[model samples]
Target: MTGYVLRRVGVSLVVLLGLSFIVFLMLHTISDSPGRAVLGPKATEDAINAFNAANGYDRPVIVQYLAFLGNLLTGNLGRSYILNEDVSTLLWENAGRSAMLSLSALVLALCIAVPLGIAQAIRKNSFLDRAATSVSYLLYATPSFLIALLLIALLSQAIPLFPAEASQSSSPWAVFTDTRSMALPVLTLTITNLVVFSQYQRSSALEELGQDYIKVARAKGMPERMVITKHLLRNACIPLITLIGLQIPILLAGNLIVESVFNYPGLGLLFLNSLNREDYPVLLAYTLLGGVLTVAGNLVADILVARADRRIELTK
Candidate 1:
Protein backbone atom coordinates (compact mmCIF):
# COMPACT_ATOMS: atom_id res chain seq x y z
CA MET A 1 0.00 0.00 0.00
CA THR A 2 2.84 2.37 0.88
CA GLY A 3 4.61 1.61 -2.38
CA TYR A 4 1.36 2.09 -4.28
CA VAL A 5 0.78 5.46 -2.60
CA LEU A 6 4.35 6.55 -3.37
CA ARG A 7 3.96 5.54 -6.99
CA ARG A 8 0.65 7.41 -7.26
CA VAL A 9 2.19 10.53 -5.71
CA GLY A 10 5.14 10.35 -8.07
CA VAL A 11 2.82 10.00 -11.05
CA SER A 12 0.74 12.92 -9.80
CA LEU A 13 3.85 15.11 -9.62
CA VAL A 14 4.88 14.18 -13.15
CA VAL A 15 1.38 14.88 -14.48
CA LEU A 16 1.29 18.25 -12.72
CA LEU A 17 4.69 19.19 -14.13
CA GLY A 18 3.54 18.26 -17.61
CA LEU A 19 0.30 20.22 -17.14
CA SER A 20 2.22 23.30 -15.96
CA PHE A 21 4.47 23.14 -18.99
CA ILE A 22 1.46 22.88 -21.29
CA VAL A 23 -0.29 25.81 -19.61
CA PHE A 24 2.88 27.93 -19.83
CA LEU A 25 3.39 27.12 -23.50
CA MET A 26 -0.26 27.75 -24.32
CA LEU A 27 -0.31 31.08 -22.48
CA HIS A 28 2.79 32.30 -24.26
CA THR A 29 1.52 31.17 -27.63
CA ILE A 30 -1.93 32.72 -27.13
CA SER A 31 -0.61 36.07 -25.90
CA ASP A 32 1.89 36.47 -28.78
CA SER A 33 4.30 38.44 -26.52
CA PRO A 34 4.02 37.45 -22.85
CA GLY A 35 5.89 40.53 -21.61
CA ARG A 36 3.83 42.95 -23.68
CA ALA A 37 0.61 41.23 -22.59
CA VAL A 38 1.71 41.60 -18.99
CA LEU A 39 2.78 45.21 -19.46
CA GLY A 40 0.06 46.16 -21.99
CA PRO A 41 0.38 46.83 -25.73
CA LYS A 42 0.84 50.59 -25.25
CA ALA A 43 4.02 50.07 -23.25
CA THR A 44 7.40 50.94 -24.87
CA GLU A 45 9.68 48.12 -26.12
CA ASP A 46 12.31 48.84 -23.44
CA ALA A 47 9.73 48.62 -20.66
CA ILE A 48 8.38 45.38 -22.09
CA ASN A 49 11.87 43.94 -22.43
CA ALA A 50 12.71 44.92 -18.85
CA PHE A 51 9.50 43.32 -17.57
CA ASN A 52 10.25 40.16 -19.58
CA ALA A 53 13.79 40.03 -18.26
CA ALA A 54 12.63 40.57 -14.66
CA ASN A 55 10.01 37.79 -14.90
CA GLY A 56 12.43 35.56 -16.84
CA TYR A 57 10.31 35.56 -20.00
CA ASP A 58 13.53 36.20 -21.93
CA ARG A 59 14.68 32.73 -20.79
CA PRO A 60 14.02 29.69 -23.00
CA VAL A 61 10.68 27.97 -22.46
CA ILE A 62 12.29 24.84 -21.00
CA VAL A 63 14.37 26.91 -18.56
CA GLN A 64 11.35 28.95 -17.48
CA TYR A 65 9.29 25.79 -16.99
CA LEU A 66 12.09 24.22 -14.90
CA ALA A 67 12.27 27.33 -12.68
CA PHE A 68 8.48 27.30 -12.24
CA LEU A 69 8.64 23.62 -11.28
CA GLY A 70 11.38 24.33 -8.74
CA ASN A 71 9.35 27.17 -7.22
CA LEU A 72 6.27 24.95 -7.05
CA LEU A 73 8.28 22.27 -5.22
CA THR A 74 9.28 24.89 -2.66
CA GLY A 75 5.65 26.11 -2.28
CA ASN A 76 6.25 29.38 -4.13
CA LEU A 77 3.38 29.72 -6.58
CA GLY A 78 4.50 33.19 -7.73
CA ARG A 79 2.56 36.49 -7.69
CA SER A 80 -0.57 37.54 -9.55
CA TYR A 81 -0.03 40.44 -11.90
CA ILE A 82 -3.70 41.45 -12.01
CA LEU A 83 -4.55 41.12 -8.31
CA ASN A 84 -1.05 42.22 -7.23
CA GLU A 85 -1.26 39.46 -4.61
CA ASP A 86 0.52 36.19 -3.95
CA VAL A 87 -1.04 33.30 -5.87
CA SER A 88 -0.98 31.15 -2.74
CA THR A 89 -2.89 33.74 -0.72
CA LEU A 90 -5.57 34.12 -3.36
CA LEU A 91 -5.85 30.33 -3.74
CA TRP A 92 -6.05 29.80 0.02
CA GLU A 93 -8.79 32.40 0.47
CA ASN A 94 -10.90 31.33 -2.45
CA ALA A 95 -10.29 27.61 -1.92
CA GLY A 96 -11.90 27.69 1.52
CA ARG A 97 -15.10 29.20 0.12
CA SER A 98 -15.23 26.70 -2.73
CA ALA A 99 -14.53 23.84 -0.33
CA MET A 100 -17.30 24.91 2.01
CA LEU A 101 -19.88 25.18 -0.74
CA SER A 102 -18.83 22.03 -2.59
CA LEU A 103 -18.47 19.94 0.56
CA SER A 104 -21.89 20.97 1.78
CA ALA A 105 -23.40 20.18 -1.57
CA LEU A 106 -21.66 16.80 -1.56
CA VAL A 107 -22.97 15.94 1.88
CA LEU A 108 -26.47 17.01 0.95
CA ALA A 109 -26.29 15.04 -2.27
CA LEU A 110 -25.27 11.86 -0.44
CA CYS A 111 -27.95 12.38 2.19
CA ILE A 112 -30.67 12.60 -0.41
CA ALA A 113 -29.26 10.20 -2.98
CA VAL A 114 -28.31 7.13 -0.93
CA PRO A 115 -31.66 6.54 0.70
CA LEU A 116 -33.61 7.20 -2.49
CA GLY A 117 -31.29 4.93 -4.42
CA ILE A 118 -31.60 2.17 -1.86
CA ALA A 119 -35.37 2.51 -1.81
CA GLN A 120 -35.58 2.40 -5.59
CA ALA A 121 -33.38 -0.68 -5.71
CA ILE A 122 -35.36 -2.46 -3.06
CA ARG A 123 -38.72 -1.56 -4.59
CA LYS A 124 -37.49 -2.52 -8.09
CA ASN A 125 -40.38 -1.90 -10.51
CA SER A 126 -42.79 -0.32 -8.06
CA PHE A 127 -44.39 3.10 -8.56
CA LEU A 128 -41.97 4.67 -6.04
CA ASP A 129 -39.01 3.26 -7.95
CA ARG A 130 -40.35 4.61 -11.25
CA ALA A 131 -41.02 8.02 -9.74
CA ALA A 132 -37.55 8.23 -8.24
CA THR A 133 -35.92 7.12 -11.47
CA SER A 134 -37.93 9.59 -13.52
CA VAL A 135 -37.10 12.48 -11.25
CA SER A 136 -33.43 11.59 -11.23
CA TYR A 137 -33.38 11.38 -15.00
CA LEU A 138 -35.19 14.67 -15.36
CA LEU A 139 -32.73 16.41 -13.08
CA TYR A 140 -29.77 14.78 -14.79
CA ALA A 141 -31.02 15.97 -18.16
CA THR A 142 -31.60 19.55 -17.03
CA PRO A 143 -28.69 21.98 -17.49
CA SER A 144 -27.33 23.39 -14.25
CA PHE A 145 -27.83 27.01 -15.36
CA LEU A 146 -31.46 26.32 -16.17
CA ILE A 147 -31.93 24.63 -12.83
CA ALA A 148 -30.31 27.57 -11.08
CA LEU A 149 -32.61 29.96 -12.89
CA LEU A 150 -35.68 27.87 -12.14
CA LEU A 151 -34.66 27.59 -8.51
CA ILE A 152 -33.99 31.30 -8.28
CA ALA A 153 -37.35 32.13 -9.79
CA LEU A 154 -39.25 29.73 -7.57
CA LEU A 155 -37.31 29.90 -4.30
CA SER A 156 -35.92 33.40 -4.44
CA GLN A 157 -38.19 35.63 -6.52
CA ALA A 158 -41.55 34.09 -5.73
CA ILE A 159 -41.21 32.06 -2.53
CA PRO A 160 -38.54 34.31 -0.92
CA LEU A 161 -37.06 31.38 0.97
CA PHE A 162 -33.53 32.23 -0.21
CA PRO A 163 -31.70 35.22 -1.56
CA ALA A 164 -30.79 35.30 -5.23
CA GLU A 165 -27.27 36.43 -4.43
CA ALA A 166 -24.86 34.73 -2.06
CA SER A 167 -23.59 36.66 0.93
CA GLN A 168 -19.87 37.30 1.33
CA SER A 169 -19.73 35.28 4.51
CA SER A 170 -16.21 34.64 5.82
CA SER A 171 -16.77 31.13 7.13
CA PRO A 172 -19.26 28.26 6.99
CA TRP A 173 -20.47 29.17 10.48
CA ALA A 174 -21.12 32.72 9.34
CA VAL A 175 -22.77 31.45 6.18
CA PHE A 176 -24.95 29.07 8.14
CA THR A 177 -25.87 31.82 10.57
CA ASP A 178 -27.32 33.60 7.55
CA THR A 179 -28.63 30.44 5.98
CA ARG A 180 -31.35 32.27 4.12
CA SER A 181 -28.68 34.14 2.13
CA MET A 182 -26.73 30.97 1.32
CA ALA A 183 -29.58 28.63 0.43
CA LEU A 184 -30.04 29.28 -3.30
CA PRO A 185 -26.51 28.55 -4.46
CA VAL A 186 -26.10 25.58 -2.16
CA LEU A 187 -29.46 24.23 -3.26
CA THR A 188 -28.50 24.60 -6.93
CA LEU A 189 -25.37 22.53 -6.37
CA THR A 190 -27.08 20.00 -4.15
CA ILE A 191 -29.87 19.31 -6.60
CA THR A 192 -27.50 19.03 -9.55
CA ASN A 193 -25.16 16.58 -7.79
CA LEU A 194 -27.95 14.64 -6.13
CA VAL A 195 -29.52 13.69 -9.44
CA VAL A 196 -26.34 12.22 -10.89
CA PHE A 197 -25.21 10.44 -7.73
CA SER A 198 -28.60 8.89 -6.97
CA GLN A 199 -28.92 7.50 -10.48
CA TYR A 200 -25.46 5.97 -10.40
CA GLN A 201 -26.07 4.48 -6.97
CA ARG A 202 -29.46 3.12 -8.02
CA SER A 203 -27.95 1.44 -11.07
CA SER A 204 -25.13 -0.04 -9.02
CA ALA A 205 -27.49 -1.29 -6.32
CA LEU A 206 -29.81 -2.89 -8.83
CA GLU A 207 -26.86 -4.61 -10.49
CA GLU A 208 -25.55 -5.82 -7.10
CA LEU A 209 -28.97 -7.24 -6.18
CA GLY A 210 -28.80 -9.48 -9.23
CA GLN A 211 -25.46 -10.98 -8.26
CA ASP A 212 -25.05 -14.60 -7.05
CA TYR A 213 -23.99 -13.57 -3.54
CA ILE A 214 -27.21 -11.61 -3.10
CA LYS A 215 -29.24 -14.61 -4.28
CA VAL A 216 -27.32 -16.90 -1.90
CA ALA A 217 -27.91 -14.48 0.97
CA ARG A 218 -31.62 -14.50 0.18
CA ALA A 219 -31.64 -18.30 -0.10
CA LYS A 220 -29.90 -18.59 3.28
CA GLY A 221 -33.10 -17.05 4.78
CA MET A 222 -31.37 -13.78 5.60
CA PRO A 223 -33.90 -11.07 6.27
CA GLU A 224 -34.49 -8.95 3.18
CA ARG A 225 -33.44 -5.80 5.02
CA MET A 226 -30.26 -7.42 6.32
CA VAL A 227 -29.39 -8.84 2.89
CA ILE A 228 -29.90 -5.48 1.25
CA THR A 229 -28.09 -3.49 3.91
CA LYS A 230 -25.16 -5.75 4.74
CA HIS A 231 -24.51 -7.73 1.57
CA LEU A 232 -25.75 -5.60 -1.33
CA LEU A 233 -25.22 -2.09 -0.06
CA ARG A 234 -21.58 -2.62 0.86
CA ASN A 235 -20.72 -4.06 -2.56
CA ALA A 236 -22.86 -1.47 -4.35
CA CYS A 237 -21.00 1.32 -2.57
CA ILE A 238 -17.74 0.61 -4.40
CA PRO A 239 -18.89 2.03 -7.75
CA LEU A 240 -20.65 4.94 -6.09
CA ILE A 241 -17.44 5.70 -4.18
CA THR A 242 -15.49 5.88 -7.42
CA LEU A 243 -18.10 8.18 -8.99
CA ILE A 244 -18.27 10.43 -5.93
CA GLY A 245 -14.48 10.70 -5.76
CA LEU A 246 -14.27 11.69 -9.42
CA GLN A 247 -17.16 14.14 -9.04
CA ILE A 248 -15.24 16.47 -6.74
CA PRO A 249 -13.43 18.11 -9.63
CA ILE A 250 -16.59 18.20 -11.72
CA LEU A 251 -18.46 19.86 -8.88
CA LEU A 252 -15.72 22.44 -8.49
CA ALA A 253 -15.68 23.18 -12.22
CA GLY A 254 -19.47 23.34 -12.34
CA ASN A 255 -19.38 26.02 -9.67
CA LEU A 256 -18.00 28.37 -12.30
CA ILE A 257 -21.50 28.73 -13.71
CA VAL A 258 -23.30 28.24 -10.38
CA GLU A 259 -21.18 30.92 -8.69
CA SER A 260 -21.67 33.38 -11.51
CA VAL A 261 -25.42 32.92 -11.39
CA PHE A 262 -25.51 33.41 -7.62
CA ASN A 263 -22.52 35.81 -7.32
CA TYR A 264 -20.66 33.59 -4.86
CA PRO A 265 -17.08 34.55 -3.97
CA GLY A 266 -15.48 31.17 -4.41
CA LEU A 267 -12.67 29.69 -6.51
CA GLY A 268 -15.03 29.44 -9.48
CA LEU A 269 -15.75 33.15 -9.26
CA LEU A 270 -12.04 33.85 -8.89
CA PHE A 271 -11.29 31.68 -11.92
CA LEU A 272 -13.83 33.64 -13.97
CA ASN A 273 -12.35 36.97 -12.87
CA SER A 274 -8.85 35.76 -13.64
CA LEU A 275 -9.86 34.71 -17.13
CA ASN A 276 -11.65 37.99 -17.86
CA ARG A 277 -8.71 40.04 -16.59
CA GLU A 278 -6.15 37.72 -18.14
CA ASP A 279 -4.49 37.23 -14.77
CA TYR A 280 -2.04 34.53 -15.86
CA PRO A 281 -0.60 33.81 -12.42
CA VAL A 282 -3.98 33.20 -10.77
CA LEU A 283 -5.24 31.33 -13.80
CA LEU A 284 -2.20 29.06 -13.86
CA ALA A 285 -2.37 28.54 -10.14
CA TYR A 286 -6.07 27.65 -10.24
CA THR A 287 -5.54 25.31 -13.16
CA LEU A 288 -2.75 23.50 -11.37
CA LEU A 289 -4.73 23.45 -8.17
CA GLY A 290 -7.73 21.94 -9.91
CA GLY A 291 -5.55 19.31 -11.53
CA VAL A 292 -3.90 18.44 -8.24
CA LEU A 293 -7.26 18.16 -6.52
CA THR A 294 -8.63 15.89 -9.25
CA VAL A 295 -5.60 13.60 -9.14
CA ALA A 296 -5.57 13.54 -5.35
CA GLY A 297 -9.28 12.74 -5.16
CA ASN A 298 -8.84 9.76 -7.48
CA LEU A 299 -5.85 8.56 -5.46
CA VAL A 300 -7.80 8.82 -2.25
CA ALA A 301 -10.64 6.88 -3.86
CA ASP A 302 -8.21 4.10 -4.83
CA ILE A 303 -6.92 3.92 -1.29
CA LEU A 304 -10.44 3.83 0.10
CA VAL A 305 -11.47 1.06 -2.29
CA ALA A 306 -8.43 -0.98 -1.31
CA ARG A 307 -9.15 -0.48 2.35
CA ALA A 308 -12.83 -1.35 1.96
CA ASP A 309 -12.10 -4.50 -0.03
CA ARG A 310 -8.84 -6.17 0.89
CA ARG A 311 -9.03 -8.24 -2.28
CA ILE A 312 -8.49 -5.08 -4.34
CA GLU A 313 -4.79 -4.57 -5.16
CA LEU A 314 -3.51 -1.05 -5.67
CA THR A 315 -0.03 -2.18 -6.76
CA LYS A 316 -1.61 -3.56 -9.92
Candidate 2:
Protein backbone atom coordinates (compact mmCIF):
# COMPACT_ATOMS: atom_id res chain seq x y z
CA MET A 1 0.00 0.00 0.00
CA THR A 2 2.86 2.36 0.79
CA GLY A 3 4.56 1.61 -2.53
CA TYR A 4 1.23 2.01 -4.36
CA VAL A 5 0.67 5.37 -2.73
CA LEU A 6 4.18 6.52 -3.53
CA ARG A 7 3.76 5.50 -7.17
CA ARG A 8 0.50 7.40 -7.49
CA VAL A 9 2.03 10.46 -5.92
CA GLY A 10 4.95 10.32 -8.34
CA VAL A 11 2.62 10.06 -11.31
CA SER A 12 0.58 12.96 -9.99
CA LEU A 13 3.69 15.10 -9.68
CA VAL A 14 4.66 14.25 -13.27
CA VAL A 15 1.16 15.15 -14.44
CA LEU A 16 1.33 18.53 -12.74
CA LEU A 17 4.73 19.17 -14.29
CA GLY A 18 3.43 18.32 -17.76
CA LEU A 19 0.38 20.51 -17.20
CA SER A 20 2.58 23.40 -16.10
CA PHE A 21 4.65 23.10 -19.26
CA ILE A 22 1.52 23.13 -21.42
CA VAL A 23 0.21 26.24 -19.69
CA PHE A 24 3.56 27.98 -20.17
CA LEU A 25 3.66 27.05 -23.82
CA MET A 26 0.16 28.32 -24.37
CA LEU A 27 1.08 31.67 -22.88
CA HIS A 28 3.69 32.30 -25.59
CA THR A 29 2.17 30.43 -28.56
CA ILE A 30 -0.83 32.72 -28.63
CA SER A 31 -0.49 35.89 -30.72
CA ASP A 32 -1.50 38.21 -27.90
CA SER A 33 1.13 39.11 -25.28
CA PRO A 34 0.72 40.28 -21.70
CA GLY A 35 2.92 43.27 -22.50
CA ARG A 36 0.64 44.38 -25.36
CA ALA A 37 -2.49 43.82 -23.34
CA VAL A 38 -1.15 45.72 -20.39
CA LEU A 39 0.29 48.55 -22.46
CA GLY A 40 -2.84 48.84 -24.61
CA PRO A 41 -3.11 49.02 -28.43
CA LYS A 42 -1.93 52.62 -28.81
CA ALA A 43 1.29 52.01 -26.90
CA THR A 44 4.49 52.28 -28.98
CA GLU A 45 6.77 49.29 -29.67
CA ASP A 46 9.43 50.67 -27.29
CA ALA A 47 6.97 50.77 -24.37
CA ILE A 48 5.83 47.22 -25.08
CA ASN A 49 9.43 46.00 -25.26
CA ALA A 50 10.22 47.84 -22.01
CA PHE A 51 7.22 46.23 -20.30
CA ASN A 52 8.20 42.77 -21.51
CA ALA A 53 11.83 43.23 -20.43
CA ALA A 54 10.80 44.54 -17.01
CA ASN A 55 8.56 41.49 -16.52
CA GLY A 56 11.35 39.10 -17.68
CA TYR A 57 9.37 38.21 -20.80
CA ASP A 58 12.61 39.09 -22.63
CA ARG A 59 14.29 36.06 -20.98
CA PRO A 60 14.68 32.73 -22.75
CA VAL A 61 11.42 30.77 -22.59
CA ILE A 62 13.18 27.83 -20.90
CA VAL A 63 14.67 30.05 -18.22
CA GLN A 64 11.28 31.64 -17.61
CA TYR A 65 9.54 28.28 -17.42
CA LEU A 66 12.07 26.95 -14.89
CA ALA A 67 11.73 30.13 -12.85
CA PHE A 68 7.93 29.82 -12.93
CA LEU A 69 8.10 26.22 -11.70
CA GLY A 70 10.58 27.20 -8.99
CA ASN A 71 8.32 30.05 -7.90
CA LEU A 72 5.39 27.62 -7.66
CA LEU A 73 7.45 25.34 -5.42
CA THR A 74 8.16 28.33 -3.18
CA GLY A 75 4.45 29.37 -3.14
CA ASN A 76 5.11 32.43 -5.27
CA LEU A 77 2.55 32.50 -8.08
CA GLY A 78 3.54 35.99 -9.24
CA ARG A 79 1.22 39.00 -9.73
CA SER A 80 -1.40 39.79 -12.32
CA TYR A 81 0.23 42.21 -14.75
CA ILE A 82 -2.97 44.08 -15.56
CA LEU A 83 -4.51 44.33 -12.09
CA ASN A 84 -1.21 44.31 -10.13
CA GLU A 85 -2.86 41.85 -7.70
CA ASP A 86 -1.13 38.77 -6.28
CA VAL A 87 -2.21 35.71 -8.23
CA SER A 88 -2.19 33.55 -5.12
CA THR A 89 -4.53 35.93 -3.29
CA LEU A 90 -6.97 36.03 -6.21
CA LEU A 91 -6.87 32.24 -6.61
CA TRP A 92 -7.53 31.59 -2.91
CA GLU A 93 -10.41 34.03 -2.77
CA ASN A 94 -12.12 32.86 -5.94
CA ALA A 95 -11.33 29.17 -5.39
CA GLY A 96 -13.23 29.20 -2.09
CA ARG A 97 -16.39 30.45 -3.74
CA SER A 98 -16.10 27.94 -6.55
CA ALA A 99 -15.42 25.10 -4.12
CA MET A 100 -18.56 25.97 -2.16
CA LEU A 101 -20.73 26.13 -5.26
CA SER A 102 -19.29 22.93 -6.73
CA LEU A 103 -19.44 20.92 -3.48
CA SER A 104 -23.02 22.01 -2.68
CA ALA A 105 -24.08 20.99 -6.18
CA LEU A 106 -22.24 17.66 -5.89
CA VAL A 107 -23.82 16.81 -2.52
CA LEU A 108 -27.27 17.77 -3.71
CA ALA A 109 -26.89 15.70 -6.89
CA LEU A 110 -25.57 12.63 -5.05
CA CYS A 111 -28.43 12.69 -2.51
CA ILE A 112 -31.09 12.67 -5.23
CA ALA A 113 -29.29 10.57 -7.84
CA VAL A 114 -28.26 7.60 -5.67
CA PRO A 115 -31.77 7.00 -4.34
CA LEU A 116 -33.32 7.52 -7.76
CA GLY A 117 -30.82 5.06 -9.20
CA ILE A 118 -31.60 2.46 -6.53
CA ALA A 119 -35.31 2.88 -7.13
CA GLN A 120 -34.90 2.46 -10.86
CA ALA A 121 -32.81 -0.67 -10.39
CA ILE A 122 -35.30 -2.09 -7.90
CA ARG A 123 -38.27 -1.44 -10.15
CA LYS A 124 -36.60 -2.20 -13.44
CA ASN A 125 -38.94 -1.88 -16.48
CA SER A 126 -41.69 -0.49 -14.26
CA PHE A 127 -43.33 2.90 -14.86
CA LEU A 128 -40.97 4.72 -12.49
CA ASP A 129 -37.97 3.14 -14.14
CA ARG A 130 -39.11 3.96 -17.65
CA ALA A 131 -40.07 7.52 -16.78
CA ALA A 132 -36.83 8.17 -14.91
CA THR A 133 -34.69 6.60 -17.63
CA SER A 134 -36.34 8.77 -20.26
CA VAL A 135 -35.85 11.94 -18.22
CA SER A 136 -32.30 11.04 -17.30
CA TYR A 137 -31.42 10.47 -20.92
CA LEU A 138 -32.97 13.79 -21.86
CA LEU A 139 -31.16 15.69 -19.14
CA TYR A 140 -27.82 13.92 -19.55
CA ALA A 141 -27.91 14.61 -23.28
CA THR A 142 -28.59 18.34 -22.77
CA PRO A 143 -25.75 20.79 -22.15
CA SER A 144 -25.15 22.03 -18.59
CA PHE A 145 -24.42 25.59 -19.69
CA LEU A 146 -27.65 25.73 -21.69
CA ILE A 147 -29.61 24.61 -18.64
CA ALA A 148 -27.77 27.18 -16.52
CA LEU A 149 -28.83 29.95 -18.91
CA LEU A 150 -32.42 28.80 -18.87
CA LEU A 151 -32.46 28.64 -15.08
CA ILE A 152 -31.09 32.17 -14.89
CA ALA A 153 -33.82 33.38 -17.25
CA LEU A 154 -36.73 31.64 -15.56
CA LEU A 155 -35.74 31.63 -11.90
CA SER A 156 -33.76 34.86 -11.74
CA GLN A 157 -35.33 37.07 -14.42
CA ALA A 158 -38.90 35.88 -14.75
CA ILE A 159 -39.90 34.63 -11.30
CA PRO A 160 -37.27 36.76 -9.54
CA LEU A 161 -37.07 34.22 -6.73
CA PHE A 162 -33.25 34.12 -6.48
CA PRO A 163 -30.36 36.36 -7.22
CA ALA A 164 -28.98 35.87 -10.74
CA GLU A 165 -25.37 36.17 -9.58
CA ALA A 166 -23.90 33.51 -7.25
CA SER A 167 -21.07 35.80 -6.07
CA GLN A 168 -23.18 37.58 -3.50
CA SER A 169 -21.34 35.97 -0.56
CA SER A 170 -17.64 36.12 0.27
CA SER A 171 -17.39 32.58 1.64
CA PRO A 172 -19.21 29.24 1.63
CA TRP A 173 -20.77 29.84 5.04
CA ALA A 174 -21.83 33.29 3.95
CA VAL A 175 -23.34 31.73 0.85
CA PHE A 176 -25.70 29.62 2.97
CA THR A 177 -26.50 32.58 5.21
CA ASP A 178 -27.48 34.38 1.99
CA THR A 179 -29.33 31.33 0.75
CA ARG A 180 -31.68 33.19 -1.54
CA SER A 181 -28.77 34.36 -3.72
CA MET A 182 -27.43 30.82 -4.01
CA ALA A 183 -30.72 29.20 -5.00
CA LEU A 184 -30.51 29.56 -8.77
CA PRO A 185 -26.86 28.46 -9.26
CA VAL A 186 -27.19 25.54 -6.89
CA LEU A 187 -30.43 24.37 -8.48
CA THR A 188 -28.96 24.63 -11.95
CA LEU A 189 -25.97 22.40 -11.03
CA THR A 190 -28.15 19.95 -9.13
CA ILE A 191 -30.43 19.43 -12.10
CA THR A 192 -27.66 18.84 -14.63
CA ASN A 193 -25.40 16.68 -12.42
CA LEU A 194 -28.30 14.63 -11.04
CA VAL A 195 -29.08 13.31 -14.49
CA VAL A 196 -25.46 12.33 -15.10
CA PHE A 197 -25.03 10.72 -11.67
CA SER A 198 -28.34 8.82 -11.65
CA GLN A 199 -27.65 7.26 -15.03
CA TYR A 200 -24.14 6.15 -14.05
CA GLN A 201 -25.19 4.77 -10.68
CA ARG A 202 -28.25 3.00 -12.04
CA SER A 203 -26.05 1.20 -14.57
CA SER A 204 -23.62 0.20 -11.81
CA ALA A 205 -26.47 -1.18 -9.71
CA LEU A 206 -27.93 -3.04 -12.66
CA GLU A 207 -24.54 -4.61 -13.29
CA GLU A 208 -24.32 -5.63 -9.63
CA LEU A 209 -27.77 -7.20 -9.85
CA GLY A 210 -26.47 -9.52 -12.60
CA GLN A 211 -23.53 -10.60 -10.45
CA ASP A 212 -23.76 -14.10 -8.84
CA TYR A 213 -23.37 -12.80 -5.25
CA ILE A 214 -26.66 -10.98 -5.42
CA LYS A 215 -28.41 -14.21 -6.37
CA VAL A 216 -26.57 -16.12 -3.66
CA ALA A 217 -27.58 -13.55 -1.03
CA ARG A 218 -31.22 -13.80 -2.06
CA ALA A 219 -31.10 -17.63 -2.24
CA LYS A 220 -29.75 -17.71 1.35
CA GLY A 221 -33.01 -16.11 2.58
CA MET A 222 -31.61 -12.61 2.99
CA PRO A 223 -34.38 -10.04 3.31
CA GLU A 224 -34.94 -8.08 0.09
CA ARG A 225 -33.92 -4.82 1.81
CA MET A 226 -30.86 -6.38 3.41
CA VAL A 227 -29.80 -8.11 0.21
CA ILE A 228 -30.08 -4.93 -1.77
CA THR A 229 -28.46 -2.72 0.85
CA LYS A 230 -25.60 -4.88 2.11
CA HIS A 231 -25.05 -7.25 -0.81
CA LEU A 232 -25.75 -4.98 -3.79
CA LEU A 233 -25.86 -1.27 -2.97
CA ARG A 234 -22.51 -1.20 -1.19
CA ASN A 235 -20.66 -2.66 -4.18
CA ALA A 236 -22.58 -0.56 -6.66
CA CYS A 237 -21.61 2.62 -4.79
CA ILE A 238 -17.89 1.92 -5.25
CA PRO A 239 -17.97 2.89 -8.91
CA LEU A 240 -19.94 5.99 -8.02
CA ILE A 241 -17.12 7.08 -5.74
CA THR A 242 -14.75 7.26 -8.69
CA LEU A 243 -17.38 9.05 -10.72
CA ILE A 244 -17.77 11.56 -7.89
CA GLY A 245 -14.02 12.27 -7.97
CA LEU A 246 -14.03 12.71 -11.76
CA GLN A 247 -16.98 15.09 -11.53
CA ILE A 248 -15.17 17.46 -9.17
CA PRO A 249 -13.00 18.80 -11.99
CA ILE A 250 -15.91 18.78 -14.42
CA LEU A 251 -17.99 20.76 -11.95
CA LEU A 252 -15.18 23.26 -11.54
CA ALA A 253 -15.02 23.73 -15.32
CA GLY A 254 -18.82 23.92 -15.55
CA ASN A 255 -18.79 26.71 -13.00
CA LEU A 256 -17.09 28.85 -15.65
CA ILE A 257 -20.27 28.85 -17.68
CA VAL A 258 -22.67 28.95 -14.73
CA GLU A 259 -20.76 31.69 -12.93
CA SER A 260 -20.37 33.70 -16.11
CA VAL A 261 -24.09 33.53 -16.84
CA PHE A 262 -24.95 34.59 -13.29
CA ASN A 263 -22.06 37.06 -13.00
CA TYR A 264 -20.60 35.08 -10.09
CA PRO A 265 -17.16 35.88 -8.70
CA GLY A 266 -15.71 32.37 -8.50
CA LEU A 267 -12.43 31.00 -9.87
CA GLY A 268 -14.13 30.06 -13.12
CA LEU A 269 -15.17 33.64 -13.67
CA LEU A 270 -11.74 34.83 -12.58
CA PHE A 271 -10.08 32.43 -15.00
CA LEU A 272 -12.32 33.73 -17.74
CA ASN A 273 -11.44 37.30 -16.86
CA SER A 274 -7.74 36.46 -16.88
CA LEU A 275 -8.08 34.83 -20.28
CA ASN A 276 -9.70 37.96 -21.65
CA ARG A 277 -6.86 40.12 -20.33
CA GLU A 278 -4.11 37.67 -21.40
CA ASP A 279 -2.99 37.39 -17.79
CA TYR A 280 -0.49 34.53 -18.04
CA PRO A 281 0.50 34.60 -14.35
CA VAL A 282 -3.07 34.20 -13.17
CA LEU A 283 -3.83 31.59 -15.83
CA LEU A 284 -0.72 29.59 -14.95
CA ALA A 285 -1.68 29.60 -11.27
CA TYR A 286 -5.16 28.30 -12.03
CA THR A 287 -3.74 25.61 -14.30
CA LEU A 288 -1.46 24.37 -11.52
CA LEU A 289 -4.27 24.50 -8.96
CA GLY A 290 -6.55 22.55 -11.29
CA GLY A 291 -3.87 19.94 -11.91
CA VAL A 292 -3.33 19.54 -8.19
CA LEU A 293 -7.07 19.21 -7.58
CA THR A 294 -7.41 16.56 -10.28
CA VAL A 295 -4.50 14.60 -8.85
CA ALA A 296 -5.86 14.85 -5.31
CA GLY A 297 -9.33 13.81 -6.48
CA ASN A 298 -8.07 10.73 -8.33
CA LEU A 299 -5.94 9.76 -5.33
CA VAL A 300 -8.94 10.05 -3.02
CA ALA A 301 -11.01 7.94 -5.39
CA ASP A 302 -8.35 5.24 -5.54
CA ILE A 303 -8.17 5.11 -1.76
CA LEU A 304 -11.95 4.90 -1.45
CA VAL A 305 -12.17 2.16 -4.06
CA ALA A 306 -9.42 0.23 -2.30
CA ARG A 307 -11.31 0.54 0.97
CA ALA A 308 -14.53 -0.62 -0.66
CA ASP A 309 -13.04 -3.70 -2.35
CA ARG A 310 -10.45 -5.48 -0.24
CA ARG A 311 -9.92 -8.16 -2.86
CA ILE A 312 -8.48 -5.59 -5.21
CA GLU A 313 -4.81 -4.66 -4.88
CA LEU A 314 -3.79 -1.00 -4.79
CA THR A 315 -0.67 -1.44 -6.91
CA LYS A 316 -0.73 -1.15 -10.69
Q: Which predicted model would earn the best TM-score?
A: 2
lDDT of 1 by residue, 1-316 (tens): 7776677778877887787788777776676665666777699999988988999889998898889889998999989887789999888887878888888889999999888888888888999989988888898899999999999999888988878899887664545677788888888899999998888888989999889999999999999989978988889889888888799889889888898988888889999998887787787788787778788788888778877876676446
TM-scores for the candidates: 0.94, 0.95
Runs in model 2 lying further than 4 Å from the true structure: none
Candidate 1 scores a C-alpha RMSD against the true structure in Å of 1.8
Total backbone clashes of candidate 2, pairs 3 or more residues apart or in separate chains: 0
lDDT of each: 0.84, 0.84
